[model samples]
Target: MQQYDVYIERQKRKRQRLIRRLVLFSLITLIVLGSMAGYHLQQRAVYAEKVEEYEQLEDTLADLEHEELLLEEEIELLQNEDYILDIARTNYFFSKEGELIFKIPDESPSY
Candidate 1:
């Protein structure tokens, strides 16, 4: 009978040790998973911010391209002799020889 009692006591100790090991492993796994989740969220936020910045830069580039096209058009217009003559005559009061130069005040208020 005493031998049987000793055998039962050893089996109980072994079962308790097994349970403790399982619990410890579960806790470690939980901690690792939690940290991974946090890191993933942080990286996602940074990616979103970068995407927003990239979109803004793209919009600015489009605006600059449009402005460049307008400037090119203006440069082409300025190369025309008719446009240059018009600007010189209107702004600088230039005219052909024997042409009367009239200095009349504008009816509308000048800003």
Candidate 2:
């Protein structure tokens, strides 16, 4: 009977040790999974921000390229003598010989 009691005690201790090891392993696994989830969330946020910034920069680049094209068009127009003369005539009231310019009032008359 004493040997049987000792064997039963040893079996109970083994079961307890197994339970402890399982609990420890579960806690460690939970900790590792939580950390990985947090890291993934952080990296996703960063990637989202970078993607938004890249889109904004792309829009800015497109705008600058459009502006550059407009400037090139203006440069080409300025190279033409007729376009320059037309601009000077409209803005500065410059006229060729034998041409008459009428000065019209643009403001509304207060009656």
Candidate 3:
């Protein structure tokens, strides 16, 4: 009966040790998983911000390209003597030697 009691006590100690080890392992696993989830969330937020910045830069590039095209067209038109003369004739009231200049009133008469 004494030997049987000793055997039972040993078995209880072994079971307790096994339970403690399992609990420790579970806690470690939970901590690692939680930290990994947090890191993933942080990285996703940074990626989203970078994507937004890239899209805005693309829009700015498109606008600048459009402005460059307009400037190029204006430069080409300025190189034409006929277009320059037309601008001068209309805005500066310049005329050829025998041409007549008329001043038409743009406002309606207040009757």
Q: Give the candidates in order of TM-score, highest first.
A: 2, 1, 3
Give the local distance difference test score of model 1.
Answer: 0.97
Clash pairs, candidate 3, are none
Give per-residue CA lDDT, model 3, range 1-111, as digits (tens). Answer: 999999999999999999999999999999999999999999999999999999999999999999999999999999999999999999999999999999988797878
The numbered model that scores best in TM-score is: 2
* lDDT of the candidates, in the order given: 0.97, 0.99, 0.98
Better of 1 and 3 by lDDT: 3
Model 1 regions lying over 4 Å from their true place: 108-111
Cα lDDT of model 1 by residue, 17-108, tens digit: 99999999999999999999999999999999999999999999999999999999999999999999999999999997899889988899
Instruction: Give the candidate order by descending lDDT.
Output: 2, 3, 1
Instruction: Please give the lDDT score at residue 92 for candidate 2.
Output: 99
Residue 105, candidate 1: alpha-carbon lDDT: 89
Q: How many backbone clashes does candidate 3 have?
A: 0
Q: Which model scores highest in lDDT?
A: 2
Model 1 alpha-carbon miss at residue 107, Å:
2.4
The TM-score values for the models, in the order shown, are 0.79, 0.87, 0.79
